[model samples]
Every structure is written in C-alpha cells, then in structure tokens.
Target: MTDGGAMLPWLVIRQDDNGNRYRVGSYATQDEAQRIADSLGGRGPERLYWVERMGQAAPS
Candidate 1:
C-alpha cells in the first residue's frame, strides 16, 4: 500500500523479438524512466510503465 505522499515506482520495459517484456530498470519518477527508455534508441521497442503498489488500482 502506498501513502498519499509516496512516490510510485516506474519501470523501463523493452520488448524482445519474441514479444516478451523485460525490465530495463526501476526509477523513482516517470521522467527518469522515460529518459532511459529513450536513450535505448534503435535497441528495441520500449516504454515506461508504472509499477502498481499494493492496494493501488491497476491502470486501465
């Protein structure tokens, strides 16, 4: 469970040719995660996603 003041964890994910999503790294902010994901240009398809904390609703 996360308190109102807590910052959620963000993950930088990349998809392999087999379409399996793998975590590149965890970050404290979405911007940080995005920067890392963007830095992997031409490496593969990637995106930033929020890691759902306990008691938090999943993103629709």
Candidate 2:
C-alpha cells in the first residue's frame, strides 16, 4: 500500500484479541487465511497496520 516501496501485495495485520500490538509483512496474495484477521478487525480491533515485507499465512 506504500506505493510499492519495498514490495507489493502485502498483508496488513495484527495479533491478540484485545486490539493490542501488531505488525505487517508482504504476502503472495489475499489468501483464505486472511479471513481470520478480517473477522478480528470486524470485532473492534485497534492499532491496525499494513505490511510491506514477505510473510506467511500464519499469525503475526
């Protein structure tokens, strides 16, 4: 989302259930696993961020 600064098609995400801390990383694409994070975001998660590095379909 940074206009192709470091990489492209990254996964912007966070961890925990209380909307605490988070991180970002580049992903191949919007894989199905993204649904988990999407669900969390709908629950009032806070401090959301976007990634710009390589990442896997796992927890941040």
Candidate 3:
C-alpha cells in the first residue's frame, strides 16, 4: 500500500483520441497490468497506452 492507504502496485494509463490521458485502473501486480496493456495493442497515433507502477511517474 502507498502513503494514501491505497494499493500502489500497478497502474494502467490510457489516452483517448481527444488527447486526454488518465488512469484506467489499478492491479495487484505489474505483470497483470502489462498483460492487459499488451492485449490492447494499436490504439492509434492519437491514442496512447501503457502500464506503470502506482508511485512511478513513467513506465519502466
């Protein structure tokens, strides 16, 4: 858990066609979130998708 008392294991970042980025959801593990992101391939040039850790500012 993080300082906020919430689980900070994994996070999914997704971008919409309108150039808006946001957190899609959280996962118990990084691998779990990575699998979901991989399955959502080719979001398009206007869209972005990636997985990251809760406290991380960028995907590693």
lDDT per model vs. reference: 0.56, 0.49, 0.76
Per model, state how many residue pairs clash. 0, 2, 0
User: Candidate 3: how large is its RMSD?
Assistant: 4.0
Which residue pairs clash within candidate 1? none
Give me the overall lDDT of model 3: 0.76
lDDT per residue (tens digit) for residues 1-60 in model 3: 453676658888888788677887788888888888887757666667799886778733
RMSD of 1: 6.0
- Candidate 1 residue lDDT tens string, 1-60: 123666547666565656565666666776776777677746634543344322445444
Error of 2 at 56 (Å): 11
Residue 26, candidate 1: alpha-carbon lDDT = 63
Q: C-alpha displacement of 45 in model 3, angstroms? A: 5.7
lDDT of 1 at 46: 50
Q: In terms of TM-score, which candidate is stronger, 1 or 2?
A: 1
Which sections of candidate 3 miss by over 4 Å? 1-8, 43-45
Candidate 3 clash pair list = none
